[model samples]
Target: MMSVPNLDQLDANALRALAAQLVGELEQRDRVLDETRQVVAKQAHDIQFKETHIRKLTHEIAILRRYRFGKKSEQLGGEQGLLLEDAVDADIAAIEQELINLGGQPSEQKAVSQPKRQALPPELPRIQVRHEPHSTTCTCGCQMQRIGQDITEKLDYTPGVFSVEQHIRGKWACRQCETLTQAPMPAQVIDKGIATSGLLAHVLVAKYTDHLPLYRQEQIFARSGVRVPRSTLAEWVGVCGVRLQPLVDALREAILNEPVVHADETPVQVLQPGSKKTHRAYLWAYAPGVFQDLRAVVYDFTDGRSGAHARAFLGGWRGELICDDYGGYKACFEQGIAEVGCMAHARRKFYELHQSGKSLIAEQALKSIGQLYEIEALSADLCAAQRQQLREQQAKPIAQTLHAWMMAHRIKVPGGTGIARALDYSLKRWAALTRYLGDGRLPIDNNWIENQIRPIALGRKNWLFAGSQRAGRRAAAVMSLIQSAKINSHDPYAYLKDVLARLPTHPNNRIEELLPHKWQPSAA
Candidate 1:
């Protein structure tokens, strides 16, 4: 090849032009690299979001199927039948196949046909053996004098049955003088009643823990040769609530004393007094950590979503409040409680938008959000202090970048667009959004409260609705106790059974200890 033109030998103007061309090419290469990086990031985000959405939808599908087909085989009403028709079944199968193609599992109809083995008796036979021995002389010494008898064989017995004999002591009057004495009876779950505490405990657990509505429970009992009315069980639950109210109150007090409290609300239908049908209400839950030295969660029910309800529940106490974006909490925050917005809620808005359509704005906003979440995920493996440090160093810059992006693009995007709405939501709550950055103790998302609401949602789907507002409140109170007991890893049925059995006689002053955190198992 011809000798390459020497730039050093060229005039200064030409060399300067060559230098500018080299610089432009280098800058173009950098731009390509950046574009490639953004494309890769977007692809990764899309994959992750799609995978998560699939999981959520799959879970919901399973739950709905359980609700629909898991009900009794009997017809729900005259029009609705339990089994799916051929066409509907085919459609469902086709839909399922499509999902499977997209990596969804085919729903299995697991028929547990147990291997047919010999059936075991509910109770085992009690075996007893006896052997007897008599003194024996050698065969040759038939006439030997009688020797002391020896007991060679033995008989063994075990008492297989236990009998409880209740003694109602009698009062006796002396023949010569009038003198009467009688002993008082010990406390029990029910006085002059046949059922034991264990049975009542089962009933409470079946009704609340298992989400078997009292009416359904009554039907089940009828199958077992008992004829209890649904109303009777409802009355029983109400009576149990009345007896256990002190414990619930104590738990509330303890929750109020906590340093960091989490609160959430869900709708409940209640049979309000004088109403033709059940009315709408809410059950608000509160949980505290550190302040009350509690590792337990508590729930409270109210007939309304008014600030008064939260104020009453919180009792004017001030601490970190972890909650969603419900306006009802505005009052509490206004009154001096530090409010931390849940990032899960913020992420959810964009997630919903993304599912509705792959709108560019929603995608962009979500990618921006992904950056923050990625930081959170990485920091999960770090200790609190390290996480705080990482957040300050790594997360702060990302957040600032996002802020700058939002500001630059906010006006260019239309107001009603999904991404624009998401951006506005974050911008409006920007202060609360950044609150986690300031403290390591705070969570990045409101998933705590979201998780708290899941059980109620499941139960609601089962029962459909409450009979009335008072009934709804009752459900809330009972659920509060049950779920709090669950959070503390206590046996809910056993705890409720004991609470119901003891509250009638338990001293009111220390009832708070019966709350999940303070509860101790009764001495053996």
Candidate 2:
């Protein structure tokens, strides 16, 4: 600190200079103080943000715990209830992971202890893995004696069988070395991975194909005498999804090669980043036309149901597209892609009208649609030319009559009425709806693709919503292979197991061979 000069000892110039210096020092101090306040304010804001995040997490934990352990959970029944339980388990684990990331401990509860697990089956085959010290000599120049060994049995599952691995680690004394040595464990698919490829494949098949969530799989595995954590299972899924992407890409290319394709999209919910809220997303599915020899489907996942996504996926491929009346597909049509509208969508409008109340017009429309379907059923097994010829000879007249009836009825009903709306839908797109009559390669409706979309709809019920966009795309890729395998009559588990084991070393150039339609299982 500087000492204050006395006014009597200072000249006028000295006094002015001292005053200027004092003002500069005061200004410097004020700037420092202002910076300090700004820093403090920023820190306070961060603390409040973290505190609010923690509170939100804590609240979510409470709600999930109540759902998991409360009476409301007890009241749930049937297959859906079991699926809900699995979803809850996964959600709880996910939130706990988030809390751990935030440097917070997961909340613990003491109520409702679970029942004891049963023993493994005695019939399952057991494999022995031995662990012994690298050396038996002691550091004191004396040989160590053999000691009793400790064995632990872990339950493992393959596709259709349960097996056990007995790990035997021998205890060796080393008085001279003053340390114990053991054989190093072998490498696995993942570091310290608890599952083998077989088990990983099984878990994946169950989750993506059977619609069994990881939480449910955890319960199933626990009952089998091993309780794998859902988080671990999720890690396995992530790894496998990355590994299998090459094959999914090959499948998509194969689908695009066909002259005619079926395309459809379904809405899915995705958890928004850094928030508890979810946003709407889409899973776009593409497959070869019904007449195409390729038995495969590929899925593209996007965050929104936009036309651009469809254009991007089906880029430059101007094949015939059999789809619904979604305006998103209009851009594709404008690009010179042929459109084959779904007849079932038109039939559905009248079907709904008929179901709601008796309507003579609606009944007549259904009868006409039913006749057209009968003609399609008769030509189901015929060749393309023959089918098209048959449609032209028989179904075209019925369709024309239906068109005339709709046109005549349009003037009778008010524009806003359900019947009028149904008639208008069929009338506006009549040409595209009946395009199948000219080309037998084109499907009569979008039902074939709708069938492909069913698995996703069913899966949504159990998995609830995708955890992230990456997770959603991963699911879409895996399910594409699974569904395609089913389409070709291949068992999903066996196919996945073989593919997972081979994917690590399979040549990328020949990746197409692994697609479901061409895949041949490796010899045992």
Candidate 3:
């Protein structure tokens, strides 16, 4: 047998060279492992995403079902239901009209170009004046001839805008005689605040509604020859919240009192109360109804991504919580809260799974789910009783079949496989998943809340981060009111303007009527 060479016989230099080579190989292997880990993580994320979307779609379907079939109550009385039904019918009508318009457009029309604006007129004439001593002088030695007629030009400008002027005619009489008194102007959003109700409303709209930063607003004011300090604007926003907090607090109480509520959370970077740099916080949004009308959407802020933060905001309340499939909400479930997932979240997963050619299984599952939604669509304009009847006759069977298919496919699937993971998630949450079919009040998904939250996400791209935790809370509160107003088909800026104008004088005892739903525009 050949003897193996011993390391003891090798020189120090040779051994050192071999050790160096081994170290390099080990480093390369480690790098490969790290890369593999990242890929695995991304794959896991993609799978979870598909599962989440399925939950979203399911929640949305439930909500549509309730709106279609739920019994009339104080929350959704006769008038509101009719309004909701009309809205849905109008949407369908609009969609059908749009399709017709799209089909009517000719293929050749795609080549048509839009007309451009006309350019400004070129110079027509030049006016020049020359003073010269000439023989045409009348009395003196200097003479002048007119090259063109001397004319006076009137400067054109926009007509000065006039505002309603209130003349308070107060009369006084002798002490022994009869007396007369005049009423004071109504209180505004700001107490003795320099800005008018309209101006404060404009500032709030610019900062919150339009997503313009205070510094940028200052620059805009400067362009208009008005000086508005950034610090001052920030103070106004803070003060505005303080004045509006009573309304927000009332709205939150109203929202919590509702049978069903929608919820969502988004990340916000807030400057720590005392720290030099900003910290990550969450803006938790809660809305009372799927369709906004009188619904209250309240936002709460917290310093961390813990379930306790969510629980604190929710308190001892136990209502149907509509949200995405984030594990963070699992704690809420443990705390006796009901969790309703979103079908949109589930659809999103399949959509992502479809990106990989391996999504055929998920696609099939989605088709069945789509059938459930279609059944709900049939009851869109029907009353709750009628909708319940249709669900029993139509939707119940589809849901039963869908549930069976998910179960049958569950066993054969791999624990970690994409489709298997989705099946497991749905099956595990099956109780909540199927709860919507039984109750007319629960929504199928949280898409309505998600849609409301989306605008803030878009604004975040430009604004990047909030200046402070106080700032984030302010943003959430204002956005809640603004988005709620938008959902009611009311102009957010106009509604806010009106609220700021009347809220001060509006009685605290009748605050609920001042809530977005009961608010009506009175002649200014």
The per-residue C-alpha lDDT of model 3 at residue 70 equals: 46
Q: Which pairs in model 2 have colliding backbones?
A: 139-176, 139-177, 140-176
lDDT of 1 by residue, 9-117 (tens): 8998977877777788889999999999999999999888767766764664464345334545421332112111111222233334334545767455522421222
Looking at model 1, residue 253 earns an lDDT score of 74
- Which whole-number lDDT from 0 to 100 does residue 63 have in model 1? 46
lDDT of each: 0.62, 0.81, 0.62
Best first by lDDT, ranked: 2, 3, 1
Q: Clashes in each model (backbone N, CA, C under 3 Å)?
A: 6, 3, 31
Candidate 3: stretches off by over 4 Å: 1-186, 273-276, 291-294
TM-score each candidate. Answer: 0.63, 0.69, 0.64
Off by over 4 Å in 1: 1-183, 289-293, 378-386
With candidate 3 superimposed using the best TM-score fit, by how many Å does residue 189's alpha carbon deviate from the native?
A: 3.0
Model 3: lDDT equals 0.62
Worst lDDT 10-window in candidate 1: 79-88
Each candidate: RMSD:
31.7, 13.4, 28.1
